[model samples]
Target: MTDTHEKRITQNASALDLAMRLRQMISAYQVSQAIHVAAALGVPDLLQDGAKPCDHLARVTGADEDGLYRLLRALAGVEIFTEVAPRTFALTPLAALLRSDVDGSLHALAVLNGQDWFWRPWGRLADGVRTGSSVFEPIFGVHFFEYLQQNPAARGVFQKALAGASSRAAVADMYDFSASRRVADIGGGHGALIAAILGKYPQVHGILLERAAVLEGARRYLESAGVLDRCDLVESDFFESISAEADTYILSQVLHDWNDEAAHRILSNCRKAMASDGKILVVERVLPESGVQKGPLMDLNILVLMGGRERTQKEYEVLLARAGFRTTRVLEMGEAWSLIEGVPAE
Candidate 1:
């Protein structure tokens, strides 16, 4: 009944709340795995019409009925699904985005992240941080890209997941390409970004430079986007050299896959092949000085899986300066992406 006792009780309650919140954060991976299981089993797609009994879902997905019901109830607790009836579940707004047929579906993204091959490396993140090296090769016995090259199914899933992001068009709109005669997308996976650029600026020709393994998919994608004729697909490695010269170059989500030295090398290669008056558009996530951004977590994911780091704005400026380019400006493309524009230094 005293003021002191009341204050002490409030403080204790706050401490307990903090503890409870931290506990949820620590165990968030269980939710991710549950979503992955539901997506992998096409549960969202099955629920597209309406709510379905848990037993029916289990029968169709070939899952144990009791296990499926538990999974649904847990997800319902998180509001991903709704328990409309005793044993029936339906899609929540969040769950609808997991349906594969949707325009901006995250089905592939969910499936890819939960894959054992991709998930295992994240478990050894401590080793990666301690040694400042990629943990993927040690666990998989090969580089991530090489593993993708060898595993067709995984590569397909990865590419699909990347394509599902829907940022390429937004990236194209972030900058003006009307003045550019030719734009080359270096290390462009499946040429999606370039296709978006070509689609946006019909006057601007596009040249897609990537590894030989990627050109086929790039060709198919560009053709599907109706930009194949306007875009030239070249098979080459950016680390070694850029075979084509263009007035504008785009490095979309590419640099964050390598360490500073390697990223610098790729930039230098672009510098060499680019026209004297050309500009390079480095499309990537910019880590903020202070705040909660996906950039930091993605940076760690890159460090563990690809040995790369997400950089602050100043870091990108310094990195550009080292590669014989000067930072001109950075434009916001959308959430999760930024357009860092640089020109050859005088």
Candidate 2:
């Protein structure tokens, strides 16, 4: 072939690669939607007893048989469900978690992200990145928390989503809280972490500091968890007030929600409230070095959602050191998150 012909062939190959990539990028939403729809329709639960004919399943779900068949095929394509034979679908391990009644259900997350609240803001992600602010406010015409307050249905769904995400991880019970007797969880919405610790250590008591409205939900969760008797729920703003007394304080995924100046204000409040020998537990994802793929996909969210970030170990250390705390240790959790221990300096 002539040199011109060879160049054309190479260029065509590259074009094909680009075309394939673009298609995949565009279809990514569809793939997750399929999974979300399958969960919403309770398709996996339908197959729990045994595999059934597609028509029978569709009738039970009040969906079109043909449409259900296509959804099952798409889910199977993504390894969420498997078609044992034509028109017969069986549950795969991945699909089992989609069952709403299951203890480990991801149904809440599926509902939240698949619905308009999260999806709409995500659509404006580019605008957020460009402006260095949340498009959530622009897209919804109010802040996220305030939106939840006004929209009760959205609020319930959001709480369920938060609980669903919280359920998958190691809780405060899994940590060593022996160093401190009294603990405070600042902005600890729902109080799940503090409740987990109180349950584990009878001697340890905790206070959950959060907004007034969220404290209602947190109280419900704490009471249901059977830890309300031991844990105190204090409604306050971290920008204005943090609990003024605690032997140890915990802030999980908190600081990243704001810029450096806001983070300093929050940490400075915690510092003011701490005992002279208090320790701060900063539970957050420690961003890995270049080329490391991480969990929860929240780092990208930091860009689009809240303008926060996942920090490196070095960044946390420096941030704490500047705030009059010594970064003592970082304990790796099973997930991308880590427990960063900071103590007030002498």
Candidate 3:
């Protein structure tokens, strides 16, 4: 009843709330791995029709019944799945997104991120921070892209995860391709962006320049999208040279996978291959200049995995200028990406 007593109670409650939140934050990796296991086991896909008993799911997924129950229960606590009845689980809205058949599925992402090859790099994140460089090559004895090149399964999962992360075709909605005669998508994984562009601009031919490891998948994807006929698949490395000449070049979610010098090389290659009055569209997540933001965590992830840092608008402008291009404008595409338009610098 006393003022001091009430104040003391309020302080204790606040401390308890903060402690609870911090605990959740600290244990987030448990949730992530659990979700990964569930996704990898096809639990979400199994439950797509309706709720099911844990035993049935276990039998289908070849998992132990009690172990599956425990996993589902823990995930239910995090709202990823819901326990509809005793030892029975159903997909939550979050769980639905993990189904491989769904639109915007995170199934591949969950599997890819939780795989030992990708997960172990985070354990060396402190070293990456200390050295101010990627820890992936040091840990795996190969660069990230090189590792993917050597591992076909990992490459497939990585490309699918990226394709599912965003609307692969959404970038076309933000830019005008009517005037573009030919568009070159450099290092375009699966040719999603160029396929989208070709789908929209029926007259624009596409040149997809990628490594031999990725060219086959890109061909399959572009073919399925019905744009393969208009797109040429060129087996080439962006770091060494670009053989395709086009008026417009697209580097979608590409540059952020490398350091500045490497990114500059890629851009300079585009500058050299593109037509005299060409334009480049750099599609990436533009980080904020300062303060707490959603991009820094990803920035740290990139640092740990690939030694690249997402840049602010000004940083991008300067990078573009160094590549012999003048940044004309930055247009907002989807919620998390921007289309930075540049022209050959005068």
Candidate 4:
């Protein structure tokens, strides 16, 4: 071939590769939905025994055979499952995470993504960006938490999803709970972090402060974890008041659901309730100064769904200061979260 023709062909190949990459990015949501559907259908749980042919899986899952086969085939290409034979599939390591019984399961997260209450606002991302506000209330006709209060099923899915996404075990170990006699987990959903802390420190008692609707789930979870006796479940609004006399206050992944003004109110309430020598731990994903990270994505998610945003260390310091507490130190917990410790400013 001529030199000029060879150069043109190479350039064409590169352009084609670029196009394919862009196309994949454009259609990435399809893959996410497919994974959600598979999880919703209990595909991973079904495959736990062994590999199953598409027909059997479809019959068990109540999915159309041919359509399910195509779905599995596409997912196999993405390495979620392996196509070991024609129309037969087995779970990959990634697919194993969708099992509800697993220790670190993503099953609930997947189901949440597919749920109407969670996914609808994502459809209005452009509107949220334009208005600099959450689309959740507009889309659902009520505030996110209010909607959850009314819809028990959605609340269950959301709480389970939160449980799946938490680094509670890690956050529980980041500080010395031995010094704390009473740890109040303000707005703590289902009592995961507090349960972890109480489980670790047998001498420490806990107070889980959450809405009345959520206290039952928290009670059940704390009970199952065998820490129910050590915990006092309080059904109250954190913005209005927090339980008094707690030496340690935990705001686990809670503040990020509200804007600055609301977050400050919650913190101020905690400050009012806390003992003079008490410490407050804000466990959240702290945004880094530069470069790309999941923090930005989570920040956008907060904006789109809840009108909140992740903040940097300086922002946290300022916020804490505004609430009459000063950030003493930041403990780096892996996986994009950090424990921002604060003490009363006095």
Give Cα distance to truth, residue 278, candidate 1, Å: 1.1
C-alpha lDDT of all candidate models, in order: 0.89, 0.81, 0.90, 0.90
Tens-place lDDT per residue, model 1, 289-332, is: 78777678888889888898888888889999999999999887
Q: Give each model's clash number.
A: 0, 0, 0, 0
Residue 109 in model 4: shift from native, Å? Answer: 0.8
Cand. 3 TM to true fold: 0.97
User: After aligning candidate 3 to the native by TM-score, how far in Å is the CA of 16 from where it should be?
Assistant: 0.9
Candidate 1 deviant stretches above 4 angstroms: 291-294
Estimate, for each residue in 1-346, the C-alpha lDDT of model 3 and write its tens digit. 9999999999999999999999999988898899999999999999999999999999999999999999999999989999999999999999999999987788999998788888898999889989999999998999999999999999998898887757456788878899999999888888878888898899999999999999999989998999899999999988899899888889988888888999999999889987779999998888878877898888898998999988888888998999999999888866667889999989
Pairs clashing within candidate 2: none
- Give each prediction's root-mean-square deviation over alpha carbons: 1.6, 3.4, 1.2, 1.6
Q: Give the per-residue lDDT of model 4 (tens digit) for 298-345.
A: 788899889998998888889899999988889998887899999999
TM-score of each: 0.95, 0.87, 0.97, 0.96
- In terms of lDDT, model 4 sits at 0.90
Q: What's the best-to-worst order under TM-score? A: 3, 4, 1, 2
- Compare candidates 1 and 4 on lDDT and give the better one: 4
